[model samples]
Target: MADLRRVTVRAKTPSEKPTTVDHLKNLIDKVGDIDTVIGEVMSRMKLESRTESQMILSQDTEGSMEWLSTNISKINYGQHPRFSVPQRITVLLPLEALRDTPYLISVIDTKGVEGTTQRPDLMAQIEDPRTVTVLCCSFADAPGGVPLSIVRETIDAGSDAVSADRLCLLVLPRNDEALKIVNDGGDVPSDREEGYAIREGQIDQQFATDGLPGIPVNFFQVGADEPEDIWRWLTSRIEAIRTAKVERIKRHVAAADNLVTNADVAKTRQARHTIADTMAKAAERFRKLRPMVRPAHLNLIAEAKKTHQNSIAASVNRKGSWDNFPVAHILGQGVRIDANLRTRDTFVRIDEAIEGLKDDFAHLSDVAQFLENLKDDVEEARKEFLTRVALAGRNLYSPYLSQAVDMWDKCEARYGAGSGYRVDVSAIFQAQFEGDPNAMTATEKVEAQVGSIWEQIVIDPLLEAAAFEDEE
Candidate 1:
């Protein structure tokens, strides 16, 4: 079942109830056990496991509303089905303002030509119900029923208020509250009115009156209907509404709308801060690697090799087999003895000491001094190793950087440079140290950019899920 939310609003038109009040009450009491009735609803709807649903009844003077919601443990299906994504399912009592309001309010621009106002809610959609009503109305079996116009007025008003694609529904119960069920099976209605009972005059009248853009609702009948039949009647409209709402968000995203925000932007950024073993986490990794990699001053492994201690054994000694992997390329890369390399944890230490001097020695002044007095090969190895690391990172991380650049380009184009999200991939990687106080080595900066892109890939989905759960 859908997760539920609650809110309170001021009451208007005291004691007046929505036209559909009795019908909803009847649906709620479909079975002797209310729990069974709710369970049936959950199964029928197949609501998203995490979607939030809120119902707003016209409030009382005490500033309270009445609603019942349930949380069902969802099975691990590939994707849960959705019904509707109404901002709020409001059962409003007052209809006077809606009845009086014109379908299209005429206005003039500063220039003086007259035209109608913008209505975003009615865009590119056909069967989405923003408002639904139940009223006593005419059908094949029942005569002398209420006019469809009465229910249309209130629901149309509701459609106008809610922005985005919308629809309205009018439900009519049989004049005889109790009657014989039809069609032998309760699932489908036959020999009686079941679904939309729209008249040609109604659609024509909607276009005639103020040239309203959308259709007036076609009514649905509740003639001796069972709960299952009603559920069938309603699900299509609800699903349509849900699809429209979800698509609206998608369309905004695809177009990179100016005001649109996404969970990915923040999630990707958070990945950088939260990850345990990042390249820039030098101090801790270096401390742990110092003992294992056997830095020059430690003299544990280097002293054991007496012959070439001046050249290859100057800083560190290799402990494990390189496994035919290139030596320079392997620096700073985590390798496993029984290598299952396809993992997020790539910082397992390469048993290389010289690479750490350029990357991690920033915090270790003693290591920097030690590097100054080293033989040419030892010092040159660190620089050559660092250059290779930077080059490989560029190859590995360019795609992530490209995507981040792309995400930001849309943002900057929409919001302008002052928005402070403009990214230039070339400039970041090409950054040089020319006396700027806040300068970073080009290699360090590349690691940062790669780190950000990594976060976006891994964290965005979790963030999006949280955001979905947070929706009201």
Candidate 2:
């Protein structure tokens, strides 16, 4: 299958467009026009469809004959790790949906992203609701009325091939006849209401009528007495469509196309029940733990941060004995970044364990034990690194005499504090390291400091006694 990650958003083709992308790994950041709805939709899709799947070292095994499979199914048969298809939807609006430019059937071969604004005077001349083109063409270019069959086939999909991604919006002018045609439907009667009446070549239908067998239509009167009426209608529709689309993609696309046994599907389908059952039990177990985790590493980072700050302040003041310490090199570059990596490694182990459970792992007890001990792996790694850093900190980072600092030899409450915020070290690392590391910049230092604060304060306190044992 073609990789769908890189999505393109532009004005429907044969017209001036906003953006374009053909490759899966590309992004066109600057929209040709930022003010339009298309621009908003484009930006929103890109943001929502962000994925971090990396290329795996596995190969496609489609052509090979297999009696049975090993770990190869995980590596070989499923979605190729390197070619992650991003989930996205590019809404295609009809020209009248534009509701603005091209008063007539004239082609808009505009040079750039400008001149898209609607002319109130020109627009007012004649929006004879009788004159809307089928798709993008003007009334003059072709016949006007939209076929109700299009609605039944797509939006009002009562039977097969659900267009779960579309929301049909028929925008008519104020006090226009077409508005009544769309908004009035009880005249069709009960028996006839079951299906769109075939008139000439197209099925005749109304927008407001309840299609007894399908979803009820909603109306958002633009000039409603309540100002929030329009917003309420739009927001509710957006959320409902979003939810329906998510379910459709999960059930129809993600689950249907991927390779797996029926038994595996049943397991995944029932996974929510498994989670629901274990939550209260897990909470009770956690509540019984003694002497919870503390983030002593954050304290070490904070102390290092303070030392770095003092050095900068002293240098600026031309004070006596200004300590030239490598605080950034030690804490900012070393410990903070390493903490993020440790968290990531811990997550990898967790993923492996979960994947193992997908097959109803024979060694369920062993896998459970491994999962339970995963966070400790992060703490152990942090302790070993800090020990070496402390020995080295005395010579390389002995900031002007204030208090003795022992990095590794700190109380177990610090390092043994379970995983702590280091469990989310990726965020902590990104908070500091995303941009240029201007070591001397005060803002950079503060970012690292805040990361440490979050690690120490927010994450560690959630289950404080997890890290330490009760002193009997």
Candidate 3:
């Protein structure tokens, strides 16, 4: 296998100037103008029908009306006169006067002579005041059950409102409610409808009435090509639109760089403060958890060291001496020798050490398992506790058997029944005769003879009885 190379590339900061006040001023001015008419419609829409001009204007009682009126006149004459308004008691300036009254801004800008598809971008520019009732009427719904007259009226009226630009009529077949609205209004009863449903992403092209073929045909056709091809084109078109948006953002940012203000400085300071606080909190939590993690890691290290030392000792003993395997030695007159029982002691020591190593290994593994499960169990318990607290409106510090059960499960997973977690105790005896497999030590030979007698007296009888029991 070839070694793979992966390198992370970082973006370089562009040499750009800070936003200027003029740029913010322009954005604010345009946004304010859109907000004005939206405010009026919100204030009076429920009171009157769509055909009626909404009228619930509050009077401005503050000073500097003269200056404001002059500014309004300049703006009205400055741009397209039909779209711009003179400083009047009209709803078009409500946002400009919002200090004295409430207002709304159209998410979509439908007033301009542009296609429906272009309006979402304009809406995206405006911040939602969270007061508007956004209706996503799809044209596919036109064929299902929705009355065409009602749909047309809704569009016409919404478009006339200041916040019409904010209206998000999806014109997709997905919205069953939209289909019902349009299909019902048709001259002939609708057979079925198709298109994307507003609440769900899947196409709601299935029509209840037979007014239209499907959502793609009735709505979102784009009129240039087949619906399937158009859908494919739209996928790429949406990406291009997103790319274009980046350029628009660049332009806005460039413009803003020409202007600066104390409010902007304050906002920056507040953001930095928030980031610092979050980082500090994270650091504090990690510091608190360090003590808990350290003990478990140290225990694991100690267990591993013990196991390594025992393994080395067992290996040394296995290859170090052969005195225990040979016959007993005896000498008289100034020197004496006898069978070495010390060898037996060494074997016992090896067995003990091996047992300890295995026990420690199991303990360490248990600890690791506990740690692995600790986070999830704690989180789950915390959530359960929190939920109880919410329902009872108090801290519930009751003891739980559930946590005990979880600990048991963790233990079993790591080391339990048939886990083969036992120490390599047989290694101690095997080590004595390891060098020469053909030859047995004195103790091994005696043990083998004792084993033969014991098997006849105990093991053979047990085996025979067990065999007879099975036959019965």
Candidate 4:
């Protein structure tokens, strides 16, 4: 099966001309002169019938006379025998004849008397709205010493008729001297600068206009001996144009996909959500711009998806450190301990364990910061527990209670009270735990144990002390 993405072109031959001696004779009988007869025949000719190729029937006597002589043999026998006839019909065949293609053709007609301004009827034949028009003429050839002013006027008139995008004017210079004359505007002060001032000066300035599509007038030498060289040059240019168009489309699609993939790799929910929204809008734009997606564009999308998946895997691995932290195991068992000194000691060891895992927090910085903040909360809770224990002993009228109270006061002065500690370590950790199964499981386990420990170690002892005081 043929790949739908690849553009294909089928070969085609030029359609045969319908002009015959009988047809020309009939037109000549009605028309007085051969020029009128030829004009009538040309006007009636069905040149538009062949959509596959662009035919340029040049009326320039110098360039196209030989071609006309060889093709139209019946023209010689008429009343205009051995008269100056146009030569060389230039044809630009399309890559795909079925498709509307951009084709440029030039026809130079300098058949008028010297010092007289005239436009050829052949210029009228160049009215295919679908194709781009290029009027090309060189300063090398001038019949009967025709001045440069007349030639300049002719070129200026042709270019003025068409829009910049659809029309291009190419002026070929025979030598370095002719090139200089063309560049200096050739004694004609006109707004239309030479599109391609070839050989010496730069034409880049002429095409630098903002918002207007560049009308290129390039200067290049055409060798009579090496005609194949010019054909190769033209073919290379056509291929370059095609390649540039394809690459431009590919670049736009790739840029859109890359933005979305980068957003997927972000750590924070707000950042990720914001960027994802942008990506969605970009994707919509791409879809509208390129409705028929190519295989190359699909490949870019696939690569972006693969990159996002890889980033997710890396993120999961980084979060494993938090999941494996033993905060829950230490607090769960320590809360049930009967001895006050031992319970306090267990918490000190838990603090040490948290401190030890600091290096593991490199990949997961937010989780590490939460753990650091949790240390301050734990210290404040310990100070409150110690003060309550001292109070409970004093209420029982126990000996050494006075000394314990003094020690509690000193500890409070040194470490500050737990009431002012308002850091939300659990909330911070929960933010990281969302959408992650292993991390959520670990967080739930730790939270359940921490809740149990807070009630048992901190609340239960205070409640028992209050009951004892009431009984006295």
Which segments of candidate 4 are over 4 A away from where they belong? 1-135, 140-169, 174-217, 220-225, 252-472
Descending-lDDT candidate ranking: 4, 2, 1, 3
lDDT at residue 22 of model 4 (Cα atoms): 48
Prediction 4 global C-alpha lDDT: 0.35
- lDDT tens string, model 3, 280-348? 343233221111111111221222223333332332233311121100110000000011111223223
Instruction: Report the lDDT tens digits of candidate 2 across residue range 105-201.
Output: 3211111111111111211111122122112112121112222322332222121122332323322223322222321343432331222122111
Q: Candidate 1 on 1-472: residue-level lDDT in tens? A: 2332122344567886433234335656666688886776667555554354432334342322112112111212212243244433323333331223322221111111011111112111221234322222343422111223222322332222123323333335455322333322444333434323223233345445643444324444443546555544445544555676676556445435322432244433343233213323432333221112211111111111221212221211231112221112222221111011221122223213324443554333333332222222322232233334324543443333333343334323433234222122112212311222222233345445334432343233222222222222
Candidate 4 lDDT over 1-472, as tens digits, reads 1111223344344664333244445556777798876666555543344222124344443435444445344333322223223343234323332123254433343233321122123223222323334445453431112222222322322222133133444445453444244444445223222322332243233233222233434344454224444344444444445564466566545545544543333343333233234323432332211111121112112222222222322322332111122222112112211123234444555466556544544244443443454444454455444333323322322222222333223323432244221122222223323434544444344334334444555444322321211111
Q: Which of the two candidates, 2 or 3, achieves a greater lDDT against the reference?
A: 2
**How many steric clashes between backbone atoms does each model show?**
4, 7, 53, 8
Question: What are the clashing pairs of model 2?
Answer: 291-465, 292-464, 292-465, 292-466, 293-464, 293-466, 293-467
- TM-scores for candidates 1 onward, in order: 0.20, 0.18, 0.15, 0.24
lDDT value, candidate 2, whole model? 0.32
Error of 3 at 57 (Å): 3.3
For model 1, the stretches where C-alpha displacement exceeds 4 angstroms are 1-167, 173-190, 194-223, 256-472
Indicate which candidate wins on lDDT: 4
